[model samples]
Every structure is written in structure tokens, then in C-alpha cells.
Target chain A: MSDSSSSFISNQVSDISPVQSSTTQSQRRGSSADQDDVILSIRSLCKSYFDAEILQDINLEINSGDFLVLVGPSGCGKSTLLSCIGGLTDVTSGEIFCRGKNITQLDPAKRDIAMVFQSYALFPNMTVAQNIGFGLEVRKVPAAERKQKIQQVAEILHLQPLLDRTPAQLSGGQRQRVAMGRALVRDPTLFLFDEPLSNLDAKLRLSMRTEIKHLHQRLGGTMVYVTHDQVEAMTLASKIMVLNQGRIQQFGSPEEVYKRPANTFVAEFMGSPAMNLIRAKVIVEAGAVKIQIHREDRAPLVFIEQAATDALRAFNNQSVIIGLRPESISDVAARDPQRSHSAECRIEYIEGIGSDVYATLKLGGSDVISRLHGDSNVSAGDRQQLHFDLSNISYFDPSSQLRI
Target chain B: MHSTIKRPRHLSCLLYASLTLLAFFVLAPVLWLLLMSLSSPTDLTKVPLQWIPSQWDFSRYALLLDWQNGSGKRFLAAMLNSLIIATSASFIALVAGVLAAYAFSRRNASMLLMFAFLATIMMPPITYILPLYSAFSELGILNTKVSLIICYSAMLIPFAIWLMKTNIDVLPEEIEHAAMIEGAGTIYTLRKVVLPIILPAIGATAMLSFLTAWDEFFYALIFSSDLSAKTIPVAIADFSAGRVTDFGVIASVGVLASVPPVLIALFFQRFIVSGLVGGSVKG
Candidate 1:
């Protein structure tokens, strides 16, 4: 299972188009010669309380100026993993190297890591300026310099008017900005955020997310952020690592994780309106492979794979799970003209979430959902023709659940 | 509509009556004490409690405050001793108990130690007095304010720690973690961040400890004999124990003894209500 999925992962990484692949290559070449580009490295990190393991042997490397997002469901240890990297949670047996210095045994303060917590964790007793400058004050920075730096950070976060207001007096977004200001004032080696935007309303979350991304771009600081929101992972991450049950399911660029997931878990977990897993039987017709999806009625729908990989060929006539995302079946998806197949099915219901219409239908003996255009005037019981993008489809072994 | 309009008014009338009854039940003794202190000797001894005094004699209070008088010096010294013991005991208990509570809350220190501290207070005061009396005598600190301070501190530390611990537990650990990650040390974090956030709890604990030490009688009765360390409560007991007891003087002393606590309670009621009592309701 590991062998096949690792091969799939490498294939996806190398499968980027000419321009992206070249720039990726050039970036690697430029960074390979100097170890300074490595901002944080974890070797065999594991965390457990008593006999209950929270994080397994985790190994990762973060480059300087990288926005790495750790995303997973609740209790997947993403925040614990971030805390380990920041020296808040001690590892069972591992070494954490921050900026090439071993910081596993170091104190959290000496590790020089700045973190913005989920609750904002702003000191309730202090004003905004006092809260932002606390780290400076604790470190015995001169009062004049601390004031200047706090003012500078306040200017950056546009918190000039709120400097004298306590956290209880500030709005949620303002408190969030103050938290960011606190982190920014320290100039720590790495920035950590544990679901820092989860507390805000949807609109504020979006604006804060955009502001954080812009701040990262402007400062070019290395950040390791933890969130259970996959959209945040997809939008903010240069490298997104999906975790489950204290293990990394997949770590790759957002496009790679979404387009070509390493395993069925990654395939299902990395997208909104998660990827659909359909039980299908593979058949060889004249030495070419086709998957017959068992529909509820009428007849079985068969889709052909013209460019089947060698890994897929190994499971020629066996039952496999066909991982199909909703967009792959939407009518608005670009047709490949040759490889994209179309099937007509009856819609069960339609849910319009303002931006897109999600139509639920029965296909391959499962309730499959499709992302349709918002203005599409289709209701329940209407027949609709959906297209399948073979290029976007993922094949998983039924028992092992690994991508082939 | 007519019933709804009239019901609240009738209900409020009943409610106010119940409230008045409860308030008088709690305050009737203090009010009677004030009347006894203000009445002349003949008025206090008269039958049917002399619901109204013939003359408002202020002579008992005058005698109590007269430093040149015989019992006046003892009363003033005992009052000073009570002040010294209660304030010092409260201050010491707060300092030590707050630190321990922080450990119990943030450091995940042994619950066994906390339970042991509580077990000391759980024991009856009579049980501690014997051993503590011997201990103080052997240590040559008998009849001194220091011995009483120690005893009161022992009695109050657990209460302080328990109150402080509960209040500290409600504060988010992430706040402290965030401060530590930003280079604040443990003591610094406690003094700056934790102390300020839990100030209400500290206020409540200090107020309760002072009140307890101020009213403590058994330890002061057994431990101190004279002007050196006898507190107000023990002195009041001595006044009542005399064969020819002056009810007016005793009432006046009782009234004077309660003044400090009443003033402190009024000053710190907001903290007490918002801190520990509020936590109990929330929990």
C-alpha cells in the first residue's frame, strides 16, 4: 500500500505543467546549496500522554519563507504537532531543529517562536499596546525601543486607535489583529498560528485570512499554521499536510493534494463537499481498461480510462473504489473532448449555497453530489447529463484504500 | 389583561415583605447590640427589653475609648493585637497560598498535597489547639502575636488556596502559555499576568482570611493571657466572664469589634460576588 501511494505522490509532484515545474525545480536548486533555507526540521517526533499516543513519529522540514498549513479533522493532533515544533509540547523522542538549532529540549521562550492562539489569548488585563509589547518587556528590551517597535507593529496592524483599549473592549477582529500584532512585534524565528481565525464570524474570518496571507507575503516569514478548515489549508498553504489519527495522510502543494491525493483518505479529506467514493469493477476490454459503475436502475455506467498508469493496470479486473470529486461531474467542468465521458442521471435534490448549486443524485449505487452552476434551473427528479474527467479521477484499491 | 396587570404588583408586595423579614432576621442581633450599647445601665436591665431607652447614654463608648482608664488600655492593646494578627496572617496566607494554587492549577502539581492542606482545615479547631498550644510554648513564642499569626495562617491557608485555585483554574492556561512563549518566566508570569487576572479571587481570599482571624476566639483564649497578644474576641470573652459584667460595655465592644469587618466587606463585596461566589454559580 505504501509503495503504490508513494509512487502516486511522486507522480503528482512531477506532473505539474512546464512553467510551475521549472520554477519548482529552480527554487529547489537555489535552496539546496544552503542549509539556511531550512527554517524548521522535525526528526522522528512523537508525543503521548501516558499510554494514549497523540502524535506518532512525525518527520517534517519547513523552508524559510514557507507558509505550511497542517490540516486535519478535530483531535488529529495538528495543534499538538505545532506545539511540539514551538517547544510548548515536549516530544517523546525526537529532535526539533529551528533555524538549524536543536530546540527540542530548549525552553519555549528560548526557542524564539511566536504563536497566535485560537482564542487570540490576548491578556485581558493589559491594553493593546501593553499586550503587544509584553514580550519586549519580559526580555528587558529598553523601554524606548519597545515603544517604537510596538508603535511600528501597531501601525502595520492598523491598531493605532485601539492601543489604549483592553482586549475586552476590542471587537473580535480587532482582538485578532492585536494578537497578530503581538506575534509580529517579537520578530521570532518562526511564527505559529493555532486556528487563529476560527473564533471570528465568517466575514471577519475571510478578511483576516486575506490579511494574514498578505502579511506573510509582505514579511516573507516562515509560518506553521494549524487549522481544521480545509479551505484555509488550500488557500493559505504553500505546502499542505493532511493529518489523520496522528499520522500524515498526505503532504503536498494544495493542487497536488486536491488533484492527485496519495491515498483515499487524502482524496476524501482535502476538499469541500468531499470527494465521492464509488464502488466500481474494473474490466479489460481489448487490452484497455474501463470501470463499470453500478447505477441504481436502467444500466451500469461504464467509463473508459485511455491513459491508465501501470499501477492501475496491476488491478486490471478487480473491484476498486473510483474517487470522483463533485466538480468532475459538474456540467460546467471543461470537457477534454476525448477522455471526458458523459452519463445521464436523475437528480434527487438541489441545494443552492448562493455561490454554487449542489445537486444530489444517485450514481454508481451511491448518492453522488455534483457542483453545478448557481443559476442552473434543475430541480429534483429531472434528468441531467454529467461529465466525468478521467484526468481528475483517482483509483483506489478496495481493501487497501491506497491510490493506484 | 386585568389579572396580569395586578398580579405583578401583588407579587412584588409579597416579595418585598419576605425580603424585609429576611433582612431583619439577619440584622436583628446587630441592631439589638447597638441598642444595648447606647442604653443606660438601668434601661438595659429593665423588663421587656426597654424597647425604647429613656436616655441615650454614650458613657460606655466614652469609657471604652478612654486610654487613661483601667480597661481602656487593655481594650486598645487587644484591638491593636487583633489588627496585627489578622492583617499579618491574611497577608502571609495569601502570599503562600496563591503560589501553591498557581502550582496546583498550572503546573499540575500533586493533588495529594492540596488535599493534605485541606485536611488540616477539615480538623476541628479544638484538635489543633492542644498540639499548637504545646508547640508554641516549647518554641517560647507563647502569648505573642507571632504564635497567633502562625495558627491563623495555618487555618486560613487551605481556604485561601482552595478559593485561589478555583479562580485560577477558570483562567485559560493558553494565556500563560502565550506569555511564556514570549519570554515571560514563571514568577514573572504569575506576578504580572496571573496575579492581575485573579485579583478578585485574591481580594476575596484576603477578606475572608482577615475576617476569620479577627473573630477567632479559642486559639486566642488558650494561647494568650494579657495585653501582649490577647485579641478582641478573647478580650470580649474575658469581659463577659467577670462576675459583675457590664452588659453595655460588652455590647459596645461587640459593636466596635464588628466595624472593621463590616467596612472591609462593604469595600470588597464586588470582588467576593464576582470572584468565588460567581464561579460557584457558573460551575
Candidate 2:
């Protein structure tokens, strides 16, 4: 309740850290934690429609209560993958297991999975209560119990006032809530959401996004969500599955997928004001590895990166692409001093959004964006010393376009 | 492409004028029929025709409806027969057509077969009349309501299938997909979900098929010989078949026969507009 207790808790944590760390490491090594916690598993899952392959070898293992988000650009098979998991679509080849039971060919009803569709797909004719209870009703749940379950879900979603209204009579956000309530009433083994908030306006989408995140946190339900919005994927997911061209580019925690992307596509697709990738030559000089950025009318911008040195060492005197997030490159005042490097880049353009300014600069023959604080009023053609957070840098092989 | 600009005033006036003229052209025949039904026998033979009858002789309607009168009993029997045949045929067609349409629209059934069905039903009835007549005769259903109902159902089923399919096609498959995934069986989903949404189409189809059967003259004329199964169209023809025909009675019968169809059209006009437009969900 007060600073003393907060300090005491911190002090207590520090005092026990060494002993706890030792025991936890051994426990982790001894126990097969992941194997027992898996709620859903897909092995060599493939889906095709007539002649075209929609998904290919989508293998995934989801932990219980984890919010797994499948994200990509349009038609990237993320939704298809979610549908495959929900048993809404047939898989061409491979096996799907839920809680260690093979349910690859089970009917969607028989498989205890519920889904909220992109269109909300709320029954247009039924009241919100009826729509929420339709699944239970179909399962032949007792009427009074169905009503109670509907009441509980309605209260959770703040849909009690709208329980009597048909979908056509409800707002988009209200309809989305009703769609979710329908799924929530089942309390199924897994929950699926196929771009549930994509239909709402931007403001509503943001609020609903927060609501969904909060819902998952409060309920601790394992959810597999599909969205084309990377921000949604980054913000809501316990683990993010990045898909491109019907193949998973990477699947990891949001930070892991962002900071250490598996490949170029995941790096570029995962961030807004995308990570700047520039082709540069790696050179070793006097037992030190330095990355050189060559320009036409100026000396090469050279900086020594702290991370990725061993990988960079293998490419001495050879080309490799360096990836840096926009926020990683900022005004010189933002330098961390520990691993930050300074670069003199000519600002090509600038866009201001009240809180910050994004200045586009030509760096190493590539257009790179540097996110600057709003007060740093640098204009185009002005050469500025931008600080790069070298600790957050990534190196990719230029030939394969994979993180080195 | 909705325009804010209003049309030219003169053009709108001309359009309204033409609409009114079209309405007059259509309603004038029905108006004439009503006037003739009220005119006396003497009023009909006056060489210079009176637009309005000098006397309103409503006895013709009474006589046609009288149970004791031979002509009235025949007319009443025909009306009953027409009612039974139209209702039965359209009902059977609706039940069978909705199932076929649900299959064609929802189950990825071959649409080519539906088109083929349409093509076969589109052929002139005369092409099959000889075989139909022989079949009915052989089955001992000739001169019966069953014969006409059978023929009318065959004629109207294609129309029912086409209308129902288009309306069902307009429904998003996601709703059914959601239902199926949520544990609703196929039949339950159709009864609870699809049926309610496509009810307008059902109404329109039923009304249209009923009208189609009600208007059938050739089939009824050939199949029904007398009071046992004679329909309104056959009765109207018989009213003018012999010498000394009572034109007032024929006019009255014509006016009454048109009543059910006009009322049905009025009730179903809104549904028809929507059902037809619903098929354009694609683009």
C-alpha cells in the first residue's frame, strides 16, 4: 500500500534472487514444461483449394492460456490457419491435436473450439441473448442454465442492456461483443478470432483491441487470433506468428519477433515506420570489426556495432544488410552512451505528429527513417548527427536476406 | 453514382403523364368489365354503347352466386377447384423447390443441373400434353383436381427453384459457417436461420407460383371436363360457349376471378422487388 512495502518487496526479491534462480534453472531443465502445457498442436498442416495451396506445413504448438496471434498482409493464409484450427475448414494434410487428443477430422461442433468471425456473423434475426445462447441451445443445454450462462457473458461484455436487440439494431461494436459472447458462453478448449475488430471504425477498433487484451488477461483463456494489423499482433499477442506468402516467417514472443526477426520479411512487416535495412560492407581493421557506410560526396559513415559482431566478423570485406528500427535511430541527445553510435545523415524529409517527428534520411544508399523528439526541429537538406542504438541492431546476410 | 442534381421539370412532368396514361390503359379494361357486370341485358344490345349503365342490375352477381341456380353452382365449383389446385400445386412446389434451392445455393451442388432443370421446364406444355393426358387417363386421374395440380406443380417448380436459389445465394455463407462451427446442425440452421431471412423470397415465390397455376387455361381445359374439376378459366369459356349467353354473368365472374390474383400481387409486390435484387450480391 505504501513505498515501504514496495521497497520491502523489492528488497525481498533481491535477497532471494540467487537461490531462486539456481533452483528455477534446474527445475526448468528437469521438467518438460512445454510438453505438458500445450493446448493445441498442428503437425505438417497443409490446406489447398483445388489447384492452389493456401497453407503449407503449418506446424504450431500453443501453450495453455497463451494469446497466439497470427498476423500478415491480406491473403497470407493467417485466417485460413485460424479457420483450420477452429475446424471450420478442412486441412489437406497433417494432424491437429487438442489437449493431446487427435481431432484432425472431428466436426467443428464435436471439437470444443469457438470462433468469432470477421463480419461478427451475429444472427440478424435473433436477440443478443438468443444469439449468445444459440450454441448452448444447439447442444441441448437446459433453458434456465442457458439463460444464466447468457446472462453471465452479457454482463462480462457489458451487453446486458443490448440483450434484447437484434444484430441489425446494434452498433458495430455491440455486434462484435455479441459475437464474442456467443463464443465465450461455450468456454471451449480454444477460442478463435478472425479479425474481429477489422470492421469497426479506427477509434472503436482501438478500444476493442484493448478490451480483447484485457478480456484475455482476466479470463486467462487460450486464444488464437488472426489479424492483418501488426500493431494489434504486437500489442495483444503472448506470441506472434508472422506469415507471408502462406508460410510462417517467424513465431515468437512479440519482442523476440520484433527485435530479432527471423528473416527480412518479418522485420519489415512487423513494425510501423518499418525497420530500415541498408546494404553495407563489413570490414575488420586492426583486430576491430567496423561497419562502413559509403556515400558519394562524403567520407563513409563508420560505426562499430556491439551486438552481431561474431556474425559480422564472418562477413569481413563482404556485404551484409543492417536492420534498425526507426526509434532506434533518434536525435543525438537520445544516445544511451553505452552502445550508441553517431551518424551524420542528410535529412531528406520530415513528418511531424505533435509528439514526435519522423525524419527521412539517406543512409548508406538507402532511405532510412529516424524518429526524433518533437522539439528537434530538423529540416530537409540539413545534415544532422543522429544517434543509433547499436545494441538493438540486427545483421542479415545480403544474399539470403536472413538474420545473420 | 447517386446524383444530387434534380431532373428537368418538363421531363418529370412528361414521365408522370405517361405513367398516368399507362395506368389508365391497364385499369380501363377492368373498369369496363365492372360496368358490364352491372348493366342490364337490354343495355348491352343498344347500338350506341353507353359508357355508364342506365340501371345497376346487381341481380346477375346474385344469380351467379346462387346455390340453387345451375350456372351459380357450376361457377362456385370451378372457383373451389381453382382454389384447391393452385394452393396444392404451389405448396408442393414450394416445399420441393426450397430443398433443391438450399442444395444449389449452400452445398456446392452443380448449378448446371439447375439450369438444365429450368430449360426442361421452359418447353411448351403442348409438347408433353399428349403423354400427360394418356398418363392421367391411364392413372384414372383425368377430370380431377389432382391432374391439374400435378401439371401446375411441374410448370411452377422451375420458377420456385430459380427464385429461392437467388435469394438464398444472397445470404453470406459465413452465417451458416458460424452456425455449423457453433454446433447447429444443417437442418436446424436452415430452419432457424436461413428460413427466417429468406422468408420474403418464399412469400414471393409462393405468390408467383399460385398466380401461375391460377392463370392456367390449356391444362385445365384439357384435364377437367365438368363440375368435378372445372376451373374458373374453363367456366368463363363455358359461359360464352352456347347461344343465349348472359354477358352480365360472364363479366361478374371475370371480375370476381381477378380478385384473388390482384390481392395477391398487392401483398407480394414488395417482396418481389427485394427477392430479385437480392441475387446481385456478387458485384
- TM-score winner among the candidates? 1
lDDT winner among the candidates? 1
lDDT of 2 by residue, B1-283 (tens): 9789999999989999999999999999989999999999888878898778999999988988897999889888988999999999999999989989999988888988899889978788899899999999999999999999889998888889999999888788888888988998889999998887787789888998999899899989999998999999999999999798878888999998888888989879977677555432220
Model 2 residue pairs with clashes: none
lDDT of 1 by residue, A88-133 (tens): 7888988899878899999998888999999888888788999999
Model 1 C-alpha lDDT per residue in residues B1-283, reported as the tens digit of each score: 2554555778889999999999999999988999989988888888777967899989888888888997788788889999999999999999999999989988889999999999988788898878888888899999999999999998899999999999888888888899999998899999888888788778888889999999998999999999999999998988889888889999999998888899999988976666543332110
Off by over 4 Å in 2: A1-36, A309-311, A332-336, B1-13, B270-283
Alpha-carbon TM-score of each model against the true structure: 0.92, 0.91
User: Mind giving the per-residue lDDT tens digits that candidate 2 earns over A1-404?
Assistant: 22333243334334544553344244334333342377898987889999998987677777677788999999999998888887878899999999999999988878889999998887776888999999999999999999999999999999999899778678888888999999999999899999998889999999999999888877777899999999999999877888876776777678777887766788899899899998788988877788888776588888876554576799999988989999999995545687888777788999999889999987678888889988997898898888888877888877667777
Span of ten consecutive residues with least summed lDDT in model 1 chain A: A16-25
* Cα-based lDDT for every prediction: 0.85, 0.85
Residue A145, model 2, lDDT? 97
Docking class of 2: acceptable
TM-score of chain A of each: 0.92, 0.90
**What lDDT, from 0 to 1, does candidate 2 have?**
0.85
TM-score of chain B of each: 0.92, 0.91
